[model samples]
Target: MLTKEAFNALLKTLEEPPENIKFFFATTEPQKVLPTIISRCQRFELKRISNELIIEKLSAISKDLEREIEKDALYQISNFSEGSLRDAQSLLDQIFCYSDGKITLEYVNNALGFIDPDFFFELDNQISKANTSFAFEFVNKVHSLGKDLSYIIEELIEHFKNLLIIKFNSKTSKFLSETILKKYVLSSALYQEEELFYILETLTQATILHKNYFKKIHLETVMLKIIKSKNVLSLDILVKKVN
Candidate 1:
């Protein structure tokens, strides 16, 4: 960020620039820049690079390097990189150095400290089945692996969000990988849409509280609340049950 004095100087330069000089400015937060400075320059918004394109580029890079990487691993890399191809390429370089043989999804997770999708799926299964023992066991496993509980809570929020999307509109599931899509298809059938929303709300609250003070026990408490939560039934369904 430029100081106010620097911005004033830049504004003056923009007003009367040297001959044959072109000024180009790029920023992710244009609103923070002085309005006068912005008025003197044209602005262009760049869209985030699509995950498919990122994956395609990563694949090309891997092939050129004569390194074998799994499609799912590439997908994970693309997601972690958000929309920056530079970050994606850098991550790929790091992973390439981390592994000697063909890179697998597990390898990517380990190298990046990312929780495996299987952990989410398994936790969801245990929660749906009300398997209290396995749910706690899952938490213990995550703790043993030194995973951040706050991050796990955030991921759980997204995991349930995906399930809700699958239940509401399977068509949009195209954003998910085939393996995860198949798992979501089966899992979505286990809960009503309302239940998924309830879980999202609960996890969101936990996330807020986690910022203040967090502990493994708090996570366990949240999981127990989720596991024992009553199914939210619509009035129509309630009336049907009454008859």
Candidate 2:
């Protein structure tokens, strides 16, 4: 970022640079750059690389290094990298040094301190069963592990969102693996579409409130609310009850 005076001083140099001189500027936020400066330079926009491409690159690197890594591990690295090739490569380097043998998804989760997806699935199951004791104990265990409560909430939101997608249209879930897809298929059966919507809504609201007053109790309270949420009946179910 340049100050107004700095832009003014650079304006002349941009307009008429020395014969062999050229100027190049890069910014993630081009709109923040002065229009006068932008007008004087040719702009290029770069889009984020796709996860498949990132995994392909990582696979090539792993082969070149003579290191064995699971395909699922590579996918996890790509996802955590969030479309940043440099970060993905750096993370791969670190993980490679961390492991003495073949890298697996468990190694990746341990290195990243990410909660296993199974935990979310089990938590959902407990909530569906309205097992408050299990829910509270699970929260305490995760808290004891020093995991961020807010991050857990975010993952829960995404977990239920995936469930909602699976319930609504399983065909659109090509991103998930066959094993995980089977689990989702089973989990989606536990909630109606309307019930999933209500859960998502509640989770979103909890996220907002958690941001304002962050506390473990807030998380536990939200979990209790979710576990005890009233079941929402679909139109067909309602009509059947009336009949």
TM-scores for all candidates? 0.91, 0.85
Rate residue 195 of model 2 by lDDT. Answer: 76
Residue 175, model 2: Cα distance from true site in angstroms = 3.6
* lDDT of candidate 2 at residue 187, scale 0 to 100: 86
CA RMSD of each candidate after superposition: 1.9, 2.7
Pairs with backbone N, CA or C atoms under 3 Å apart (clashes), candidate 2: none
Report the Cα lDDT for candidate 2: 0.82
User: How many Å off is the CA of 159 in candidate 1?
Assistant: 0.7
Q: Could you tell me the lDDT of residue 220 within candidate 2?
A: 81
Error of 2 at 120 (Å): 0.5
| Candidate 1 least-lDDT 10 residues | 228-237
Residue 236, model 2: Cα distance from true site in angstroms: 8.9
Q: What would the TM-score be for candidate 1 when compared with the true structure?
A: 0.91
Regions of model 1 farther than 4 Å from truth: 230-240
lDDT of 2 at 61: 99
